[model samples]
Target: MIKLPKILKYPNFSRLYYAGLTSELGSFVTETALMLLVFKLSEGDKSKLGIIRASFLFFLTMGSLLGGPIGEKFNRRNVLIFANIIRIPIITVLFFSKDFYSILLVNAMVAFFTGIYNPSRQAMINDIVPQKEISIANSLFGSTMAILHMVGPFIGALVFSKMQGIDEILTFDLITYFLGIALISTINYRPPKKESVDNVQTSLFYDLKEGLRYAQKREDLRALLFNCSIAGFCIGVLIPLLLPFVTEVLHLSDREYGLMLSVFGLGGFFGGIISHRLTSKHRPGKLIVSSIAFEPLLMLLWLLIPVFIPNLIIFFFWGVIVFIRIPSQLNYVSETVETEYLSRIHSILDLSFVVPNISGGIIIAFIGNSFTTMEMLFCTAILFVILIFFKMFTSSSKALFKSEAKRVTRDQSIQDGIA
Candidate 1:
């Protein structure tokens, strides 16, 4: 057996890790359950299902937008605990919801709180871990979530197979949340110093605008955000269409679909491990950009390849590439940005996906029913490929160079101060 890192030995981080693990496991279960429920409620109407999903995302985005300041200003631990606590009742309501709209409403509410939970948790992680160890921390954190994502679906499948209803799964989800609350309560954390009462308070709008101004001033931050935004848009387009592609285009069974998903998650787990081990030696930004750039080409390949086995193989690798960049990507942000502004920055980045998620279906719909699925996919792939290269080479090249120089200078200053 491999020896555990010394960081894992820290009781507080360990507790926090377990809390996240349980919460993620539960979320995945709920995710699977929600998907199934939506399918049932919509009677497998793809359009309606999309609407439900979009609804949840809309509220989530709004929550994230508003939650950023709260995370930055408040006690993150309390915020996290409250977020989890509030979710219980919301999920409980979801359990008993018989109507589709009720389910949608409850889900939206839950997602709203989730938006709060996520940034608070992320900010808290930065507080708990030292700057030097962030990469390892993220890798371990990413790996745990990936593994849970891989297994949770199976657990959901098993439970669904046994119970054949959403109720039992919801109950399990509630229990997991409770456990998460219990686990996280034990963690010791310190919030930043409060602003002096004598100082004039900035309005929320002012604070938000300030964050935007800060981001705008940094060419690298802007470039990175642009890259992330594009990536999120492309990903959003792919997510809603994956099930249909697997079932209709690939002609795969539900079992095969589940297997494909599991394999994909497994790939993510390995990718996280590799990222952790290689962080010191590798150019993470390059690796991340390269992986995302390759995604379109990979999708195109998956679409063109007629063989199911080959497609699964391609998809597994796709998963690896998808998750492999997360730790690096996040580490880059944490390393580049000031701690005081990190949560707001995360919230801003979260919008990249949120906007795309809400608009993806509309984009798909406007293209006309006459186009074949393959044609649409092909066009999307080509567009993403072009856009990605253009963004990297034309738009962000100078920014990246500037950011690198700035980072070096900052590091030197810090070292000089220490010396």
Candidate 2:
């Protein structure tokens, strides 16, 4: 008999979790389909891939800027539903988009609405799950995301190879959004107690201002947002580099490429489990900094040893570090941020990531072709190291590490006394 994760025992959370699984799977599928479609349409112009991704993510960033305010000011459930509904036409337009520019435009539109959906959904976790279970909840969400990220793209690619048409793929994506809407509708949420008629009456602009102010007032959040920007840039650089590295450097086929992602996803799945189990034992911030700091070092090492099997092992470890970082970061935020500002703060975090993510795409687009994949990857490693060094110096990180140090010292003192 299987025992469910404790977080999943909550009825509302279970429903929302399953709903997220469906929507997230569709989202990854759509992303893969769009990438393939644009690649073919542009005659394998790798630069265009960067352009499409950057544009898609740019609008997502912009939309997120507004999404936080909108989600907080209006009914969150309604916000998610409306975002899903409006996205239908956007995905439909992809069927008609033939040129690179048109495809980019349609994808950007889709990203914007999807962006709106993300913050609301992230913040919604608080409404459905108990406060004590937040870490487990985040870990579960992270694991689902890792699994879907691998499986969804693999499914999309398999279908595309067989059908050899973007239209069918687009239709599949559209259907999923409808399913997402249906699932979202079924979720019953408990609105925040801080939400009152008076507070709700405030203008979206006012809420937006307050959200920014809230983040501005907090040093820890400011550091986290800054860290996000650095991660964003590294992520931007990594995305365009991965396929080329696997295929060109490793001299492997598409199947090998998929296997690489599968291995990473497997690592991420276990990482989430490890993170969830450790929630009771370690500080979230300690887990976050420890996991995140070591990740880039693995990236640096991966570049040094380029054989396929060894690199597969490396990718797995990288994935574990990532999953550890993700849940710990989310848990940290949940503990600190007020429920009222949760959506907006998440939106800000998204923007911090996406803005540099767009820049990363552009870097790969222009600077990438000039260098070999290995060389470009080395540059990525350098950026990641820089990001980590930045993390070590942040005030929040110091405090987190300090707290862990004190705990260890106290534990040792008690053992000495017993002896």
Candidate 3:
């Protein structure tokens, strides 16, 4: 077994972790509150909710596109700080918005900053942690996100229910952003100076083109991105369906539904722990492919089995297996790709995940009554299974996997030699 280094021992990583924790915790509350606010403002009109969400998502995708260049071309820490600072007032104004359109405008602005924030924050992780320790860093970060997802909604709901207004919660979220900025500003990181030969000036579009070319040249990286994109789409489709399945299909109460999410979070927490230990032991290519393949099978099983206890168990592992591979995926990128392209690749990957997310609503709307939700789930799961198998066995994928295994071996040998 490969031993993992302690991530918290690094002061900068610790600060980033705490900042992320606070930020995500606040996000959970903010997201829940925003949804409630939208529902209230629209008088329970579901179509309006969709419009609001789509507006935010549209700008978020745009933000991510711009984030790549902004993150790579500037000081990442300052970029992150600016991102947070910009969000504070935007969210603050959300509380005072008189109409849904005003709220939508604010949401768009916040999301644009978010696109900038996420890539810069990710780049910061790649910057502060050494390649060997990147997996641990990502593991810790991924775990925090999982934990937030588990209880953040419940907490957000609770606050919204009790306070009877979005203002307090919005203020709280603003404070967390403030805290994130403060904590992040304290990290002692000096950005690396740009290195170039022949002094060629490159436009942002040029950088984006070059990044795409770089990803295209590496079979392994392309395979990883393609597989992740498919998996992300599946996740997007399934996520919104979970609540409906729990409430309607299982006939479970809200409290029970919350517990189920908590259990999933617990599974993710443990998975993060397990991932830290296994990250060094496994080959990245195999780990990523196997985990991606495993999830759809679980989703299919979820549709087949209707019993609550069995479904609960499945959800637990669903969280575990899915979260476990994320750190490994990020670690693979960190180790295999050169540092110069980290921000660009991260932004590209981020866009891949978000772009598919919008399709989930379409999937839900399309299959709403044609088949039962569970049946739809089964069909989607099967679709993912077919896609994964086909992709894995394809000529390009096979070559990618083979070359990736060799690269992992070479990288490990170098790390061991250094140790």
Candidate 4:
């Protein structure tokens, strides 16, 4: 029910939002098809699937690290447009390749471009929306992604079922990327005079170092990064394990599993709507903390729930908590950092997720195929507790909220005076 505010009524932001939606929906299709193709080609070996998934994450991390400098050195919109344009060739190659290694290589390339695209796109959004409206804007964006996740796969499935070819799905994804690029190309992005080239360091290594150093020196950012890293590590364990758990332990079919994922996406959509409304009136830090605190507990309860029911209600709650928390964290990062440094900030923050994603898979793999569901749940709980306790000790939420409010108010007052 939450509506986008007047601040987001600008045509540029609207174009960006639509572009994001189209691209995300395309990603959903590509991801679903890729996973299916991998499983089929590998004879249902979960390890291969994990490798495919991990490779994409690895490339994404590399891209994130590289993107920071590029974002600062060039116009962000140009970078985004270039990345999207590059995707056409990459995806075109994917349409022909069915080999495991080739598919993995192509997928990694796609993810690499995505990494470049994401930070620049996000930085652009930060530039477009008002300081106070950042959180709500992010929530709306999250909502769009959630809805796409919910519907995109179903549409993919329908298309794939009819066409019965990876080429068809790849073509669909490629077209969406082109659509996104066209939409983004129409936007007018004027970098603020204050954020011009003189303000940004020219050296890539020095710029990268500055970004890392800035994150380290900023109290709220440092805490946010640490807490989010722990959270990502925990979630990384759950993500690959979910489908297996549902199929192997709960004995759910592919169709049923897909439905469960859709339900989770729906939960995310609802959560995003709620977050969009609340962020305009309340501090994002509080909402983030509450959501993070609740996720582990709900996940733990989900583990305890008897698997008798055909539908998994607990998964819905888990999805809701996770989705709600994301926008709050994103809002904090996007709003607190300077526009010129926004991409670097995002890259650094994303490292929290990337490191864990790559390492978590290997750790889980080594822990053996025999690791029980309950054991995994316990590990997740422990990590969650550690993160929550650290946040409490640092009182990060309170500090960030107060500081952000003061910064925004000051910016607004200055703008008003100038106006």
Candidate 5:
């Protein structure tokens, strides 16, 4: 038998890690294929692509409104399984979709279940991993995602380039989804003793309110939520804009664009390894704020440089900074939240990002083909500035960035708890 890593030695988390890894890769590949399908079905309307993406975000947000309650009310593992199982039929329908709206609607439905899956899985991480290993666990997850984002698109593009029909990609997605469920079934999870099963609230609305209230009560969480939203908005805006920016302004080919993504992923994987080492010495909050402060500047620098080689360098460096920041952020949240409130707070955090992500897509979609590529590029540039300035300057942001800076890592916190 293969010897597991220290953190993966936890039986439940180990299964969850593999299950989530495969599921995430499947999602990325399918997402790439689905986008191509929608673009083709819509007869190459670029705006519709943005619309499809935005609709997914909107519906995902809607689903998350209830995911928190359900996760808190039901067994979390069951919720994760249900999230995957429910999507099989929906994805099956995508293979038959002929119209743009049908494609959009089906994918958006997948997003709803995914919205639930995201938070429950996030919340569950703290439960299964040993506190000292939280940083490494999160690094593994983030690194895998970065790798998928790097490669999944290319695989999807290649598969679709050879497409006999949409069914092939959707069929693959369903198989992976089923595999995710099966892996989840083999893993065993035990909720902490304090999380009484009988204590579930009858009212999901009230349960949600309680979560919102919990965030409002804390200075740091409120700040973190704000940061999550802005970061999401940056992502949202970039999604619709980046391709155009590369092709039109930078005069790079699709191949170069793919290369940029791959390099970034490669850098992120290394950065995650570095971060795994850093957690032993530094606080997660400090890692996060440092990443946040440097990112927009790096983005600004990349935009200014504009050469293909330098842009690749910037993308790679940015990815490294990002992967470093993510694990630290995850470690921070894991150490901070109480057991009972963890799932709900995570859901609220998901909404924090997803809602703004929707808005960003809508903004780009609304811009339409009316503006020249330069004008949209100009608009995107403005977003970068705002993203930079806000994170660096805001007062509550200062408190938020510093909030966990003085605190100990999860390992230390766990030690303190035992004492």
Candidate 6:
């Protein structure tokens, strides 16, 4: 078991975590308020709101697709700082936009920059953190994000309800973004040395092909990515339907819906804490499978609870299980990949979700949300079950566990060589 070190003891990591928390909280506040503002402007029309939300996802996907090559080409920390600086004006524009199209444009821009920001930030962590502690670090990161989700929306709701308009929320978000920029700028870490100039001079197609080839050649990583893409697709189905289910089927109000999201965040927060502690004690594959198995059961239970209970007790439990899956999965991905390619690999994995999310939205639009959710959940559950069985029969699970061991051994050998 690899005992994890406390992040508080690492000054740089502590600053990074605090900055991420503040920025994430601000983002949640801004997003929630923006959704409300769009609703108000559209006269209770949901389609426009959906379009606004979907545009952000679309641009984010574009940004991530571009982010990999840029991060590899430039200093990732500088890119991150630059991304933060660029957001201020975009967010400010959003604050005063007179029409829905203007607001959508600004939000889309913000999403694009945020997409660029994420891969760089992830790469920075890889540069700063030790290999052994990557899981714990990622867990802490996930926890902070979950905490922001838990508190940020409620704060946004309260501020929105008390204030006259969305401007205040946008202002708050802008302030946090600047604050994050300031904090990130203060960090003094150097970027990892790149491959030689000869390596750098390769055509863009070659660079991308290399990344793709690396992914295809790594057997364990290939399996992990396959499962991750499937799980992401399932999650895409679940996310859009959750609020609707709470409102339409459970007869909940907006406040109740917010509360349900908060519960989910709380669950994620605790899951992050648990994962930080448990990563050293168990195989990540085992943890991932357990988390994946729990998700469908919880979703099914969420659907069934309405039959017996008057209130949303099962919703809270479902939130816990659902949130738990995120950090565990992230840690697994981080641990599976080498540090040099971590950012690009993570971006590729993220794209798996982005494609599914966009496709899921379209499918929902065509088939209706309820049917889409049911179909996705059932299919995902059955798929994971089959994978688990195949893994057991073919000894793939043992191979995955051994892969981690080999990674650690290789790291030790490198360190010993340097010594």
lDDT per residue as tens, model 5, 236-314: 8776666566667788644564567777877788778878788788767667777777767776787778788898899
Range of the 10 consecutive residues with the lowest summed lDDT in candidate 6: 410-419
- Candidate 4 structure quality by residue, lDDT tens digits, 1-419: 99855645667888888888888888987787676667667765556656777778788888888887788778888898899998889888865667988898899999898887887777777776666667767988887777776777666555655665578778778788889989989987765444445665468777778899988777777667766777777766766666566666777654555566677788888989888887777777767767777876776676666383533677676667778878988887765677556778888878777777766655655552666755765677677776676576565555664545323221332111111
The segments of candidate 1 whose C-alpha lies over 4 angstroms from its true place after superposition are 1-3, 194-198, 362-375, 395-398, 401-419
Q: 1-419 in candidate 2: lDDT tens per residue?
A: 99977666666677678767877777777777667666667665667777877888899988898898887867788888898899888778767666777788888988898788888888877656666567778999988877876687677667766777778767777787788788778766545555476544777667777888987876666666677788788878777667667767888654566667777877888888888887788877778768768877998998999999998899888888888878877887777777778888888888888999999898778876677878877888888898778778878667654433211101111110100
lDDT of 6 by residue, 1-419 (tens): 97644654666666666678778888988877676566667764544644666677778878887776677778776888888899888888765564889888988999898888887777666666666766777877877777777777667766766774877788778889888988877776666666575554765345556666777776656655655666665555555555455555666545665666676677677777777677778767667655655655565555545542432455555555545556666666666666656677777767766766665544444545235334544565565456544654344444554445334211332211110
Runs off by more than 4 Å, candidate 2: 1-3, 195-202, 402-419
Give the 10-residue window scoring lowest on summed lDDT in candidate 3: 409-418
User: Clash number for every model?
Assistant: 0, 0, 0, 0, 0, 0
Candidate 2 clash pair list: none
Point out the higher-scoring one by lDDT: 3 or 5. Answer: 5
Off by over 4 Å in 5: 1-4, 41-44, 194-202, 250-255, 404-419
Distance from true position, residue 2, model 1, in Å? 7.1
* Candidate 3 clash pair list: none
Per-residue lDDT over 200-234 for candidate 1, one digit per residue giving the tens place of the 0 to 100 score: 77665666677778878877667767767766666
- Say which candidate scores most in lDDT: 2
Ranking by lDDT: 2, 5, 3, 4, 1, 6
